[model samples]
Target chain A: MKALLVAGEKSYLNEISYLLKDDQFRKSTKNMLLCYHSINKIIAKIPFRIYETFDCNEIGLFIGTSHGELETTKDFLKSIGIDKRARPFLFQHGLHNATLGFICQTLNHTGPAITVSNRFFSGEDAIDLAMDWLQLNKIKIAITVGYDSLPLGLENQVRGLYPQSTQLSTGSAAALVLANEEGVRKILNTNYSINLNNLFLERITYCRTSNARTGGSTSTHYYDSNAIEEIYNNLSRYPNHCSTMNLQKPNGTYSVINMAS
Target chain B: MIASTTPAVAVTGYGVVTPHGLGIDPLWSNLLKRQTCIANDTGTGIIDQDILEQLKYSLPKDDGESASCGREKSLLMALYAIQQSMLHAGWTSLNSDDGLIFATTTGYIASWENELLGFLSGSRREDSFQEAFRREPLGTMLADICNGLNFCGHNLLITTACSSSAQAIAIASDWIRLGKVKRCLVGGCETLSMLTSQGFDCFKLLTRELARPFDKKRSGINLAEGAAFICLENESTIVDRQRIQARILGGGIASDAYHMTAPHPEGLGIYNAMKIALNDASIDKSEIDFIHAHGTGSYHNDLSEGLAIQRLFGEHSPPVYSTKPIHGHTLAACGVIESIICIKTLTEQILPTNIGLKDRDEKLKINLPLEHESVALKKPIKFILKSSLGFGGSNAAIVLGGIS
Candidate 1:
């Protein structure tokens, strides 16, 4: 039932400009293009032998985003307001699941694909769902991505809403390739015998602070969407150890990810 | 029916707020009467303003200091549906460990449009614009629902366009089966907005006339808006047999990996999803009494789904019907809303007909109930299948069984 983190990649702000020049991503919207490149990077990093074991039919794709296609949505809305007509392409690409479709089509992957949103905790939520699918033996491998592109003229608005938020002002995407023990063993080839415990997600927990006056709590915290990349960095740096990373926003809403070798 | 080894998942309670009216009573009655709720001029199904105002007043007032205040219409609809569902479940409050999975395609889009339009025109005040921007993110809807209901367990907001809510139900059922939670609240909410209607119109997917599913001259979909929630629990957790409404036999999800707006020409993805769902339910195709199709009345959607149905069930395909002609297509909310209708179908031993069909499309070659055909089963209805397809090639199906 263990989900091993086999490969990962990330892109932040200007680092994603290279995708804009690629012909393969020319028709892709910003968020879709960003995710496409990130997933490709993860695929490229996988060993040839392991990559050969991937079953396109059994691979699960999970995407998490705080504001999906906001930029395209704005453009579509503008078209409606000024021209009194909206573009069909913009309307199609403006959907939140458009990125999921784009990735699956480009990769020729037919699997269980879903897009989830939990604000700042979207990354963890995506990873958690991926892990559950793996644990349930539903798929051989899971590609989980967390992505968000801030809409134009909305950065200041976000900052005003969450003054202490550090990562909500920019656009970024992070991806992880996870597999169960049996799938990982088969992918690595039994002869290679790579340690399955090098790095794997052990657990995930989401917590929110309760309000005493209202008897209910609101999620006002905004945390980094690329926290998964940070977890990847920590696990790689300190091998053969257990690590617990606590990600907390100023408002006391936080999530914890347990990684172990 | 095939035997299942996995833990049984039960549907204990359900509620809805559709254009037909609030709750299942009005929707069922309207469907039986073959009523079309879409407005002729607007080509959309709109909920009454008085019902909305009454729902708003029934909800607890938000304290000014809370960030969850100033909610959008979609979130308000979701809260009202949740209220109805909880009350139907005979629970005054939710356990801290209960989970929630929400689905929506356009989250606060109307509010965002208003704010952005004002900001661009330079005629609106900045303070008012800022207030609108605060409610922009789709996740806020999930948070607001949690705060309103005091639900603090596992929760997620799914936005896979039209398939969003069906996938939410699937995931909630998975959670219950895996012992992640004893019970979960699964729901979808969508409110009419200029972006959706005009956007679909741009694609030429909106009907100029009435929606007619499986009809030779059927134009396209009639965009609509609503919210629905169904409470799913582990069958072992339910102590009262009278509380059980139906059993969630199984669910499956898959992507077409085809065009962004168009489904696979042959309906390969839809067929695979239905097959997987039947397998998950551990049942043979013959066990299903009928199917609630994602028949949007759009040419491509109806043809593709019909082909999928033909491919799966072959010559013995069960009677298929789409309620869009009655309630219009509610986009993301159709999955759960139609699911509630399926529950009613199983419990009542009645089958709804495809309302606006004047002439069946011969190319489909699938069994479709005729307009004005009212089918009341002499024996108990056993199982039903509900399927949904989204704009991004997302497809999902769920199997529900009547209580034995």
Candidate 2:
């Protein structure tokens, strides 16, 4: 099976609109839309010819989001009260799968659709699932997405872990398409595991690390881009590099996704 | 090339924590009497304060540190249901190869509500962030359930709105069929949250009275909360066939791309999903003996779902029923909860009547069994189909049946 990185885009909260190149897509998806739309915008950036070659009915979509649209969720929550209620739009788009449906409608793809979340390392899970679907030939073409947005209050909570990520209102989304044929990098093998250790909690409570600090964000969504960028940058040298990406959610569990490089 | 058949997965045991109470008996008995179990939420506040107050009384109290984190009700219900399921399946410890697929749309939202309160009031406590991280993250919920059940294998969390849990069951069965796992604990759980309660209220989707699916006087869904789990073992892995509650024939998931919240007017997604499920099971439409529909009582949902049923089964459509009036619309938990109901119907051969249906819409051609006396089938129910349609145009259908 071949894995192709068709389109990848990451937009911090400050620049999300600018990254959505299509004005019509942006206008239709602006309100009540969340991380899935960002992923759709990335998927939209892919060449139309690539989509034209395959029937939309033959394509499937799989997305992973750790903390989906925290900003919108918070907004919706804030609007609920005895005297007030959330807007119908917020009610419609607050769901994690809302974006998944929006992406399907936008692309006119009607194959199998799934939204999976494993906290911080969800991106790796999405990639791993995409490869499995391709191996099973469930779909001739699969669109995989990993997306999450950091709302306002969340940045202050994880500021210690993500010292390099100064913007609290930041989020990142990345997407790629894959098939059972040749692509940029061949996926030899992939493994994923969950580690329930106090070490993850200690990192949060004490911010302690043994080795040289690798500047990073604590978001599963932000790290989603890191994994994709790593694969893209090392596609040539990493013909057979076995590498593992470990991310720790605040819940004190370590999500490790291993790519047999 | 020849088409390959999906491996049949056996539903060894199941458990539920619903408004009717704990276990299968309570829910079944309540449904048998056509009794409506809608609870009122008169308490008005930022978080549906009364429901939380009632939860304190209804559910067992959390012992120590975790209680303060919030939304312990959902976690408690999930643990309770899983324990019952494990016991029914006659298992002690899950093998390292077993997987858990959990579904929920609102995971510890009450915990986040606390954090949001602190955020808005500018009184964010030093430990509030830690608490939100610990309690509100969906991963924490999964990890908690895994630890509670002593499971350490593959795990997946699905949040596909209302169809979440039904899809969870389908995926778990797939894992077993595809050799990814030997066994799986598949289910969905949901707890009352201010967000969805008010969201549905904003959309005016909540019925002022009891929800009546397919009834001409039907108003809307009654927002309810609960959790359910079913232990699914591969047919090849089962040591004894006598313990099988029902066999999972197949499942199909699809999207309409039609609208954000409303279903396609023609019920296109529902039709596609049901058709795919029948194909996956390698059965003709004539084989379906009964259907457990999504039936959320909204004007559009009922109409769309009814149209889909009519188009698919036509005159051959078997008995149809909706249990939301008895259990309320539990959203994410509806899939597994409703699937468990189907299994019980297959075993008992007594279908639950459609409660609160004073009048049926004449325009819809589907057969909805309304009278309690006529609910039970004279012959054994062989196969049952359960379906769910959620927000974002997501849809899922699964076929289950008595042991072959």
> Residue B258 deviation, candidate 2, in Å?
2.0
Candidate 2 Cα misplacement greater than 4 A, ranges = A1-15, A19-52, A55-57, A82-85, A158-169, A181-221, A224-261, B1-6, B40-71, B123-133, B372-378
DockQ of candidate 1 relative to the true structure:
0.56
Residues forming the 10-long window of minimal summed lDDT in candidate 2 chain A: A196-205
Query: Model 1 residue B242 lDDT?
Result: 89
TM-score of chain B for predicted candidate 2: 0.91
Interface RMSD after interface superposition, each candidate: 2.4, 3.1
Q: How do all models score by TM-score?
A: 0.94, 0.84
Tens digit per residue, CA lDDT, model 2, A96-213: 7777877777766566788887665566556666665655555556667766655565555544334354343355555655555422212222121211111100001111123433
List candidate 1 stretches off by more than 4 Å. Answer: A49-52, A164-169, A190-197, A210-224, B1-5, B60-71, B375-379
Residue by residue across A34-147, what tens digits does model 1's lDDT show? Answer: 787788887676654433576654689999887788778777887888667778888888878888889888877678899988777888888888887787777778888888
